[model samples]
Target: MPARTPWIRTFLCRSDNIGVLMRDPETGACAAIDVPEAAPVLAALKETGWTLTDILVTHRHADHVEGIPEVKRATGAKVTAPAKAGAAVPEVDVTVSEGDTVSVGALAGEVWETPGHCADHVSYVFAEAGVVFAGDTLFTLGCGRVLEGPPETLWRSLSRFLPLPDETQIYSGHDYVGSNARFALAADPDNARLKARAEEAQRAAAEGRFLIPSSLGEEKATNPFLRAGDPALAQGVGLAPGSEAERVFVALRAWKNRF
Candidate 1:
């Protein structure tokens, strides 16, 4: 038997937060990456007719878990939260840490302790499915704000995705591609790929579409945060070639913070 691809749906919620629903066709088991809000998740389930089986939380942020209780009460779905989140998140039926496997029917995702956006942040990498639900740790062309740990920690967390295949699909927590594209252009103006991606982002926004679920390949080629080791990015950030990637990354993030 071959591995079946899980069906995925992406929608906007809570102004900029992205809502995701992943369903296993073999067993009809469905999981929502983060709630953001209950209405959209419920409506999506109703529209797709996919039963909500689980809610996988990436971090303890209120925007991510605020809809858990209502959604759980309505669907009786199990909730899987990060162990480090502790009491910050509610209605957690299971707490997972690094290397833990979370199963939604026959589909399984390896839990990576990708803490940088927050102390409890975790990313779900369904390698076989070629998908990773990266909460706030990574975005379209940027990374999360360093709120909990140093930029080095966030760089380490982002590095977890570096080893994945180019085609791996990444679903981040928010829709910040427009701003990220602008920032990417400012940070790596010499990269033609970044320029093209920024134009694509502009067109997508004009068409009322989003650039969520971007491939690791695209991110690597265009995202400045992921290209900290590239000499072009180092120079763009006013650093010399061969500068430490971690140092470049910190400078880039600081520039982004002020950008």
Candidate 2:
């Protein structure tokens, strides 16, 4: 029988913005996924009772990295970010690129350069934890807009994530599940999974439960951005049935931005 992997507790700061905390069970060390603001981040640290050991910045967005200095000043944790994002994130102690590994106590993660939302964007894959800090690149049932790069770049970035083990959990930088679900419904109105998910998200929000950390398998089934290659998705967007996957993806994303 395969040995059980240690379970790490994940906390959603839910600060009306984004911040995720991953704590190492053995060492009581915590890795901050993205610090949207300082106050909530500090509060999360206090609530978790875990000392901050590292900060993983997926992009140079102010909302994501603006709190680095304050958090660092308070906890003195090492900051790891993309090499190209150095100018934006001056406090990053370690510059990492695609395939580079970072560890906080017993927790380890690999950095995947995922440039599209921004040229310097990257995603951290914590294999042992079965989670990916996708920043603004990918969201629950949606994805980031092409603010800086070509649609092709965004498509490539999204594609790189598709093949991860199906059960891999995705933790995005924003809480846009309801909005994403609305767009997904417009993009594929007849999709039962999309319809059910949209309803479920509405109910969850009404009850004040955060809908996040969606699985890759679930995204593959429901996210219009990730399912752009499907013939039905192409049809919904008025693309030719035989359209290239990238073209369909680009159209779907363009539509969602306006959605």
Candidate 3:
């Protein structure tokens, strides 16, 4: 891993979508993680005075890929999308799969095929920078709904993140901490760490500051989805004690869907 960290700028886009601009300070090579909208992205570029060199697409969702055409036309940046997305996403200049590396100047991010939110979903882990752009696969307190895959599939995808360093910065696609906190509390009410986190979420909301870039360590400690392996969580979800982690995860996901 590189010793230097990339300069990161996080902003909101299109309602609740979290937009990120990651730049390598050494070379001024900047990448937009996903384009929720073009106007704000272009404005951010102008505001920061950093030229966009790449658009690292996370999935084929309309909200994520809608701004690609406009942004690409404006900056001529190379667009890299998931190979599994095929033609579902537009204006793709390159396609990447698992183990592929994407470079933004001096920084490199490894591509992980993390489906479950959708069959084409992927995540970008900049190990050198200790950050992961976790599309819709994983979120702050909750995880993405299993829209295109089974709950087990989604759990498997989430498992991929567990092995990262505790300090790894996690950048998810949306700012759903408010709603997610409610569900998390319902599912894991007795968790002291979760209670504290929920209060912090409230404080962040009051200040208009989002908890977008959460740490992997914090998620492990408090996120109900990540803690599904705990026997207590299985009991909370009405499952018998000692239920498999995957089963507990399915129960939690189902409850969240209705919650």
Candidate 4:
């Protein structure tokens, strides 16, 4: 029998927003996911003792790519970004669209066009690792705001992930788990699962731990944003079940923005 390759290690930078490190354990090669700033990223790299080999930029947002130059200067790492985000990314070494593949060490990742939060947004899926670096497109129990596309666009982007294996872990760009959980509760107040998860998340945050990398199964069950088309979600917000999925998603997003 062939030996199984161990999964790569993922480290959350836990910056004010989000930055993550995907390290190939065998080679000590690392890939950074959206560097908000260079200092924190450098510190994180030093702490982990991993050499950065590449950077995956999800969108053109400053918070996501501001540190690209600095990190690149320090490590000379190759950069990969969406083809549409060429101008926004200053030092992109490779530009890819949907279905393209990128590699670091022995691990391979496929690019998924996930626009909505930004027209140029993308997500990277490491199938072998069962993880998705979901930029600002999808959060733990929430999704990004509709800044550049219609709510339907965002809904479609999010829906693409629904068919993945139930155990696929979602690593989002922000640690907005607590806020999202609160909104989830409001959207499904009577859901025992949501309530239980929210309480657990609150306690985790209080203890200075982040609630993230939420499983797809957990999300499908409690994330109102992901369940916009569900009858329970529509009923919770007083919308009829026959309403369009986009309409439900829009209403839920608008409500959560205030939440």
Question: lDDT tens string, model 2, 145-231?
Answer: 888979899899999988888888888888889889988998888899888888889998898775677889889999999998899
**Model 4 Cα RMSD, 1 decimal:** 2.4
lDDT (0 to 1) per candidate: 0.94, 0.83, 0.94, 0.84
Q: Where is the poorest 10-residue window by lDDT in model 1?
A: 1-10
- Give candidate 4 regions above 4 Å deviation: 1-15
Show model 1 residue runs off by greater than 4 Å.
none
- The deviation in Å at residue 112 for candidate 4 is 0.7
- Where in model 3 is the C-alpha error above 4 Å? none
Each candidate's root-mean-square deviation in Å? 1.3, 2.0, 1.1, 2.4
- Tens digits of lDDT, candidate 3, 1-259: 4477898899999999999999999999999999999988999999999999999999999999899999999999999999999998889999999999999998989999999999999999999889999989999998998999688899999999999999899999999999999999998889999999999999999999899899999999999999989988999988888899999999999999999
Model 1 C-alpha lDDT versus the unseen true structure: 0.94
Q: What TM-score, over all chains together, does every model reach? A: 0.98, 0.94, 0.98, 0.93
Candidate 4 lDDT, 96-133, residue by residue in tens: 99999988787788999999999999999887878889
- Residue-by-residue lDDT tens digits, candidate 1, 1-259: 1256899999989999999999998899999999999999999999999999999999999999999999999999999999999999999999999999999998999999998788899999998888999999999999999999788999999988998989889999999999999999999888898899999999999998899999999999999999999998889888999999989999999999999
Model 2's TM-score against the true structure: 0.94
